[model samples]
Structure formats: C-alpha cells, structure tokens
Target chain A: MDASKIKQGIHKSKGGLIRSFVTIENGAIKDIDVSGDFFLFPEEAFFKIIKELKGIPAKRGKIQEIIEKTYEKENIQSPGTEPCDFTESIMKALEDT
Target chain B: MNRWRFIDFGLVDIRDMMAMDEAILKGDEGNTFFFWTPKKSIILGYFQKAEVELNLANCKEYTITRRISGGGIAFSDDLGRQINYGVVGTIDNDLFPLDIIGSYKQICGVLIDTLIHYGLNAAFRPINDVVVTPYLNTGTKGARKISGNAQTRWEGKLLQNGTLLLDFDIEEMLRISNIPREKFLDKKIASIREGLTWLDRELGEQRDMEEVKGIMKRKFEERFNVRLKTGKLSEKETALTNSLLPKYYSPEWVFR
Candidate 1:
C-alpha cells in the first residue's frame, strides 16, 4: 500500500518566515500544513487554504493560482507577503522528492 | 479624544498575561494597554509548532507559553529587565487603519517615536520589529532588533503585543531558543549578537523600570493624542481571564 509522506520547506519572506510541510501521494497533494512567523488576517482562513490545496495536482502554476485565489476569496490580509512567496515555498516543497 | 485604559501588571505569570489579553480584547472596551514583566518563559506564536521552534529541554528550565498572536518565538522575564505590552483596540480607520500593513506601520511608528523620546535612537523595521542602528566598526547595513511585535484579531478587536528588551541575556536567549543550528551554532550566535540589541546595551546601564514605563505611557498618550487612565481589569475581565487560563496551559494549545 502506497501512502503519502511529508516533505518540508522553509522560505524567508520580506519580514518573516514561511514554513510548509506537504504530504504527497501519487503526484497529488494529500495534506499540507503551513506555519510561520507571518501575520495573516482571517487567521482561520489559513487552515482552510491548506485544505483547499489538498488533492490538487502538484503543479507550480496551479498551486500558485489556488493560493492567490483562496486568499482573495477569504479576504486574507497577509502583510509583507505576496502570493509568489507561498508559491515559491510550495514549489520548493514539491521538489523535495 | 480617545480614552485608553492602562494597566500595569508587574511580575505576572505568562499564562495569566495571555489570558488577560484575551479577556480585554473580548470585552467592550474602547482601547487598553497592559504593561507587565513576565516570569522567565518562552512564548511561541499561535501558528508555530513548539517542537520545531523551541528547545524543549531548555524550555523545561523555565516556562513555556503560547500566545494568540502570530509571530516569532520570544523570551520574556520578570526581573524588571524587559517590558512587555499588549494593546487591544478596534479596527478603525482613524487610528488603527482598516488595512493590516497600515495598522502595523501606525503602531510601529508610535513605538519608534516613544523609544526615541526615551533617549534611544530607535526605528521601525518593516512588518513587525523595532530596531536601533548603532555606530560600529564593521558597518552592518541594517539595524539591530530591539523589540518584536505580533497581533491577533478577534471579531473587530485587534490584540497587538510585543516586547521591549531593556536588559536581556543574549546567552540565555540563544540557549533557550531554537536558533543557531548545530552546524553553524557559533557563526549564527555571533550573527544574532550583531543583529539584535537591548536597551541597556545601547544605554550602557540598566534603567529604572518605572521610569521606562512612564516614558512609554506618556509617549503613547502623546502619539495617539489619547489620555490613558490608570486602571485595573474589570471583574468580568478577571473572571474571563481565569476561565481562559486553563486553555493557555493545556498541551493542545501549547503544542498547537
């Protein structure tokens, strides 16, 4: 039985740090946990953002699009962070194979 | 003219301090600022993983607590050396602008002005820190961090909390924090020493805590153009704090 395993990556943003741990199985995201020293309004939206990314194919642009869309849809105000920062973190994690 | 409640809770336990901040932010208050020096402890940000960010063995030597706000981990003590403050207020355009970045800048600006008025040349470092750039032989480009801040918003109220390192033990800070990875411990510690500073390190001596508080209070009042009445927590707030204490002490909350 094949199961997802965790891969982690950390990125230093302009003012803080972004750490992402992702579980991937069969080339799709199984689970993800994003934690850091950064501030994000609608703080609860963070967990939801991670959940939304689950089951999505591990493609850079697609994952980036979802991150940007979820933040906008949830009205998350993450100071000193742009969507690219998160995308870069996810991309790094996916490459951790 | 906005009225603010100023409470000076000296030598508090970290858990109780966190609970008090939660309660005040929940209450129907205009704005409140709490000043306190906590017993030696390491406070982890809300979203941080204690296992990843803290040196648990070192934490056992003191105390470990987690805050509702999200930011980096911090070391705080009650020896009248460091001053910790928590501000609770609504998200308003006039004072705490509706935008997050603006609010941080506004609050950091107040803190920078306050530190300068207190006879230290302080400046606001982007996102969430207050720092001082000292004249040195090596000529580091950026300033050294003297203060760190974090915030959490519940409903419409925002709880912005931070620490002012007056007289800190950099050695102890490095010992307890998960900084200076094993491979580069020596180099990292040296770099950290260069990048961070304390008030006493800049001023050359430990100053009176009360005098420091007075300066901070007066500066806050002046910057915000608000008068703060010295006060204590309301009965309801006290009760809420007591109830919330257990949550802060729980393993689930701390580890989460």
Candidate 2:
C-alpha cells in the first residue's frame, strides 16, 4: 500500500487499452497514469484532459467527488463517450485499495 | 455562416489571443485577432506537462512565453514572425472533418496552396505538418516545415491556431528543441534545415510582414468561402484578455 509501490504498478501497466491507475498509499493518491493503445484520437489529447483534471483540488474524503469532477472537466460529448462511466472506473480503481 | 474577422496586430502576446478565444467561445464580444510574441517561446500543447516539454533555463534566457494550446512544442522568435491568427467561432462539424487525417489534409491544403503563390513547393506532410522538400545537393531533404498548428475545443467552439515561420534562428531552435546538439556539429545548420524553411529565407530577404498577412487572409477567405472582415478587439474581449494575461504570464502557468 506504499505510494511509491502504487506509482510503480500504474506506470508498469502501460498496455493497449485506455486505462488509468491511481497509486494510493495510506488513503491518499500519490501518483496516477493513464495509458492505452492507438486511440481513435491522439493519446496526447486524452492526456490533456487528465492534466486539466489534476488542476482541481479535492480532499482525501472526497475521492469519488474528485473522480467525478475530473471526468466532467474533460467535457467530451462525442456520441457514446460517457465521462461519468469513465469516472466510475477510476472510482472502482480507488476502491480496490 | 459568420464572416471571419482578421486582426493584424504585430507582436502581441500569445496569452491575450488565447484569452480572446475563450471569451469568444463563451459568447462574449471579441474580435478574432492575430498576434505574435516578440521573443522565442515554447507553447506546450494544453495537455502536455510543462516540466517535460520546456527547458526553464532556455526560456528565461530567451524570454519566450509558453502557450496553453494542445499539441507538440514549437519554438519561435521575431525574425519576420507574423502575428498568429486565431479563428474563434461556434464549432461547425461540417467545417472540420470527423477524422484527424481528413482534417489535416483539408487545413494544410489551404496552406500549401498559399505557399505555391510565393513560388515555394510546399506539401502537406503526415501527422499535421506542412513541409517543403529541401534541395538534394544542398544535403537538405528540401522538406522544410513552414508551419505548425494546434487545436482546442471548448464549450461549442474550436480554436485552431499555428505559426508560419517567415525567418527563424536555427541556433535558437536547436537550443530549445529535443534534437541533440552533436548532430549539428559537423554539418551546416542549413543542411539539416529540412522540414523547416521560412518565406524570408526562400525569398533571400525579409519580405513585408503585412504582405504575407494579406496573402494568408485572402487564402482563408477563398478556401473557407467566407468573407474576411476587418475588426478590432471588442471591449469585452479586451477586458477578458487583460484578466487572463496575468495568469498566462505567471510562472505557475508557464512552468506547470
């Protein structure tokens, strides 16, 4: 459950599907990484959305709120692209801790 | 379709233009203006990590401000560098192709055609760059990159802005880019100038910046089939840009 350990795990899971991992140690996110294969759009574009999300401030008690806030920040309205579902996945990842 | 307004203010800050774009997207009164930075600066793509993309020492020594747009890093200085044109309007799905390839071909086609007017053989290279092939005997690929563009979509509007390097300092670019220094040690910098060229360089003299702007405006009008209207910054646009300028010029935004 060490923060460094979580960071390492997320960084190592650089597989093909668009996946994000948040490294939490002692109930606080220490690191995060979003990676995937060739996306319909540029990976850089998605990363930009993540960067904006990181700009917001959230308390440790508001983990789900943080995820939702970050997802809403992306503002992607393309057909079938659900930001809320994406946030759910991140919340699930955090809950796994 | 709304007519595109052209503002030709020379060497205005990039932050102002970005703020103006945001205001326009938010339905605030603002005129689309094209402005250039006076010093060499790296505008990191909106999503890029500034720490990863910019060299702090280099930017400070050279005095270039970073931009908020998304895409690869670009280095620019005032060697005939014209004001950057920002087209602000409602996002028209019809105007922008759904796919990246189609979009690149469409936007770059207009640029290539414009360059052809100046007698330079410019071509649209893949992944979103317009380049001219360097001469063979010159040991240059002749594929000099004349422009680099980036886009930002917000609310219901999209802003695509880029630069056309009229004349650039190769040494300054080499200092800022990810290219290794040793590679330029043995060859003339000009030889390696493939995928990069300037109108002034091609013409062997510094051409009038206003003339170049006129040509680009004409091309945009013809290709987009919209009249190019002349306008200045609206009061609301000016106020927004003024508000955003401090943050954009701040160390936090630049070094973030």
Candidate 3:
C-alpha cells in the first residue's frame, strides 16, 4: 500500500465542489492536483501552495497548515471555499477509506 | 441616478473577450456594463484543469480557454445562442453588496426579473446560478440551472461575468465537457440533460437575442436605479486590451 498509487477526493466547499487527485508514496504526497469550479482570487498564487505541498506528510493537520499559510501569505480570497476545504479533499485522497 | 456605460463588443475571439474584461477592470473605465459573445469556446474556471474538466478529443473544434474569474466550466458561441454580460465597477457602488453571495443576489436579482419578464420562471440559486424548475406535470422536480456567474475582485474594483442560456446544444455541451455522474446525482437527476434548462426550452420558443438584450438593459437600470447609457470601450481599455492580447493567444497561457 505504501507504493505510490493514485487516489481521489471530492469536497463540497462553500464556493463549490473541490476535487483533488493525489499520488501518494510512503505516506507522503508525491504529486497532487487540486481542481474544481471554485473561486480563488489572485489565482496565480495557488501555484505557490502546490509547489510547497509536495513531500508533506499525508495528514489533516499537516495538509491544512500548508494551505492556511498560503492563504495568509498570498491574501487569497476563495469565497465559498476555505483553506480547510482543500485540506479535507487532499486528506480524503490520502485516507480514502 | 448613477449612469453606467453599456458596451457591446460584437463577436470576437474568446481571448480578446477575456483580455477586454481584464483591461476594463484594470483601467479607468468607470462603471460599465458589457455584452459580448465569444467565437465558440469552452471556458474553464480559474482553478479547473482542462484535462480534468473537458474531453480533449471533442474539443478539437473549439478553442479551449480559461477565464480570469472563477466558476464552473461553460461553453460559449458567437451564433447568438447564448448571452454573456459583465458589470464592472468599484465594489463601493451603492447597490453592490460588499460580500460575495450578497453581490450575487443583487445582480442575479436583475437577471431573475429579466427572465421572469419573458414569462420564464427563473429563480436565483444561492452561491451563483439563476435556475428554473419544471412544472410538476413535467416529471422534473428540482431547479435546473440556466445561468452561470462568477466574480473576481482587484484593488477597489470588481468584475462579474455571467452567461444566460437563451439556448444551448446539450449534445455539444456534454461532448465538450465531462459531466460526471457525481455532479447530477445529488439533485436526483439521472443525467446532465435533466439538471439543466434554458430560455428557449423553458418557454418553447426562441426570444430574439437583440430584443432580449434591450430588455435586459432596462432591467439593470430599473433594478439598480441607474441609467445605462450606450457606450464604447474607453481609449485606455482598448489600448490595454490590445496589449494584453498576445498572452491570451500564447500556448503558455491557453495550455497553462
């Protein structure tokens, strides 16, 4: 199970549905893609979080911390969508059971 | 009454349409309302990946593009089958609510009134859609969406663009975009066909686009208590939009 495999998660955020597909290897994120019909202001800022997410332990606290920090640093405004929404989706992908 | 400029940028390339929207947001365009149609394209939400949301094999005939604002994926055509409109103003406009959902309610209220004036039973679904439900006898219970709207804020300004589905080709829409079963399942619908409605289908007749546009113009003025004077893009906006065009057409942007 530790061998890298793809998993998916979907969350209904305040903004809209957010879906994440993660490639996990050894209980850490090898690759992840967050996609959806949600709003994120200054969207160019998202790449920063994506770049930082790699290799982070696949846990709720650890995943959410990364997104929350990015939301603050980038002044992100994702109406109807929150940092935790992204966290929930990523975590679901990590712990899909 | 506060008067806002109304500009119609006749059918143009999708990239130009997006560039123009950004230019108006960044430049000193004052308060303006714009009506534009993109030459056939499937526009992706800001956060969506084309490969995830669209069927690339079916997209060869259409230009795949992304909008500066965030929202669901949608299709557009220059053949007068859809109506696209945007309101650009400093978020401080007296009637524009400062909060996101509040703003949608305010603007979509006008759209709801407009559609109702045409005898369509349009309603605003929270978050961001104008929808209409079929009569009970029709065997469809839930509201089906007819319009898609999204907003983006910058500095002190906000630009919101929404499209009203005066008409649509469901076959083409499904062909271009993958409507996952999970999307319509919550609504108790078996397919995207059941989850969507349009002006033509709801009314059983086509409303002349030009006539509908005229009525929509009046609805905005009436709803906001503002006069929308027919106008053209400002010199500053035109120049900036032209300058920004190259990036939109570049592969890095379209494919990025």
Candidate 4:
C-alpha cells in the first residue's frame, strides 16, 4: 500500500461513541466530517473545528494542538469527548484498517 | 426558591419553533420550559451531513429542517405522538451545575422520573437519551429509546431540547433517514431501535397528549423542587423569532 496515497477512514473513540471521518493525502488531512450523539456547545463550533483541521499534518501532536487551540479560542464545550479524542480518531483513520 | 416558567406554544413549524428556542435563550435570563408539537420533520444536528444521513427525496416528501443544537437525527410529528421540550436558561450556578455532562445527566434524570411516574420504567442512556426497560411479555428487543436529547450553549445561555416519543411512525422514519439494515449504519440504528419502546406500546394503549404533559410537569416540579408558572412568549422573543425565521427556513442554513 502506498503510504502517501489519498485515503478515507472512520474511527470511533476508544472510550465513547464519538466518531470522525477523515480524508487524508500525503499524510495530511484533506477533509473531515464528524457526527455522533455527543454534545458540542456553541453548535457552530462543530463545523469550525473541522475546518481548522484542513491541511494540517496527521501527526498526533500537531492535530492535538490544533483541536485544543480551536476549542479554547472558540469557547467550545464538548461533553463526552476531549481534544485528544478527535486527534486519535484522525490518526487511526490514517492507519491501515 | 427555584422557579421555572413553562410555556406551551401549541403546534408550530420547525423553523418558528427552533427560532423561538434561540430567542428565549438569548433574550431571557431565567429558566424556561417551552413546548410545541411540530408537523412531520426531520431535525438534523449541526454537524450532520444531510446527503449521507437522510433520504433527500423522502425529506422533500415530508419537510426537513436543520437545528443548531448538537445531537443525532430525530423525528417529530404533529399527530400527537410526540412532545417537543426545550429548556432555555442562563448558565447559572444556581439552577444547574457548571459541567456539561452533569447537566445532561440531571435533565435526563427528570425525564426518567417522569416516565417512571407513568408506570413505564426508563433509564438515561448517556450523552443524551432516555430508554425504557424490557419488552417482556412482548416479542421485541429490550431497553428501547423513548426520548432523544441534545443541547447547545449560545449567547451565554444554555438551550437543551429533547423529544419524548409517545408514539412513532417507524415506517416513515425508515423512509426518511438513511439508516441501513446490514452494515455499521445498520448496527447504529439497530441498537437504537432494538430496545426502542414508545409510551403507547409500553402502556398497552394510546395516551392523550394533555395527560402526558400534565404528568411531565408534575414530575419536573417534584424532581427540581421548583414551581412551574404557565407563561407565554413575550414581545421580544416573538420579534426575534420573526427575524430568525427566514434564516432557519432558508436553504443555506438547512444545507449548511
């Protein structure tokens, strides 16, 4: 399998049902979508958070930093999920299933 | 003493109802319970993709709308089979705890208690849902969902909304949503419905909407130790709803 090829995958959180879908190309997230029963405040932040991930490296540290910063700056409150949950989901999507 | 206002706006369209919720949360500072019955509509969550989760043709057949609240797909109809409940209030330390999940748990507890009062055992199924217990003596799955809930914090206030399914049109639901029957999506909807039980199904008979509302109001008062004063939408809230209705009914917002 080519590591840099564009790919799509889904990952449900380790501890919860929060799920994320990611489209990756050359180890970078090209697009993503999230949906679940989990609650995220400032409801508009749901789309904004996903937008912030575009073009970001798929590395865990980089993804984590971006998610945390976005949530903090936007005052987004997500119950049943943390910033690392999304970071890990994207990383898992990058991995071969 | 804790106090909450209970406002019943009767039947309304999805756009007006959703706008009213936001307006109350924006313009009011105290706790409020808003009630309304919506015409058949598929309410999508803020982050949900309409193309992937819903059947566009069916949505068109039976009007669809997107809500700003964060939650999974839910169906409601004005056939008196469901009651839409919305709670709007400031994020006050006095009314509820400051934690997000905690507040969800507390509100769901009230809902569960309401069901229990009706002799139908129910339980809170984390994040935001209430499920009724075993379908024993019947040939269906156990612990089915009777309620779906979601919330959002906007404009320094919290708006929590939920639907209590007194009855549901399963056929219509299957027709509208893209819930599959043999894959992951299948598993998702399967677990959701396997134990799904409605009020009429659980009670072995159809129950009137007023009866359900009366019991629910009493239950909330008992659980929260608050008085619920019957109220109506004020001029400010009504005006805001008018201004917000166009956006809610607009294609840009619904498809966004």
In candidate 3, which residue pairs get closer than 3 Å at backbone N, Cα or C atoms, i.e. clash? A14-A80, A15-A80, A15-A81
- Choose 2 or 3, whichever is better by DockQ: 3
DockQ of 2: 0.07
Name the top lDDT candidate: 3
Docking level of model 2 = incorrect
lDDT of 1 at B76: 71
In angstroms, the error of model 4 at B22 is 0.6
> For each candidate, what is the lDDT?
0.79, 0.55, 0.82, 0.74
Please list the residue runs of candidate 1 whose C-alpha ends up more than 4 Å from where it truly belongs after superposition: A1-4, B77-80, B135-140, B180-190
- Would you give me the overall lDDT of model 1? 0.79
In terms of TM-score, the best-performing candidate is 3
lDDT of 4 by residue, B1-256 (tens): 6778889988778778888888888876478877788877777887666776788887775566778776777787546588888887676665555777677777778788888888876777666778887635342235577898888776557788898988887777777776533223422445445646688888889888988888888878887788999888788888988898888888887776
Off-target runs (Cα >4 Å) in candidate 3 are: A1-5, A95-97, B77-79, B134-141
Q: Interface RMSD of the predictions, in order shown?
A: 3.4, 9.2, 1.5, 3.7
> Could you give the CAPRI-style class of model 1?
acceptable
lDDT of 3 at B105: 84
Which is better, 1 or 3, measured by DockQ?
3
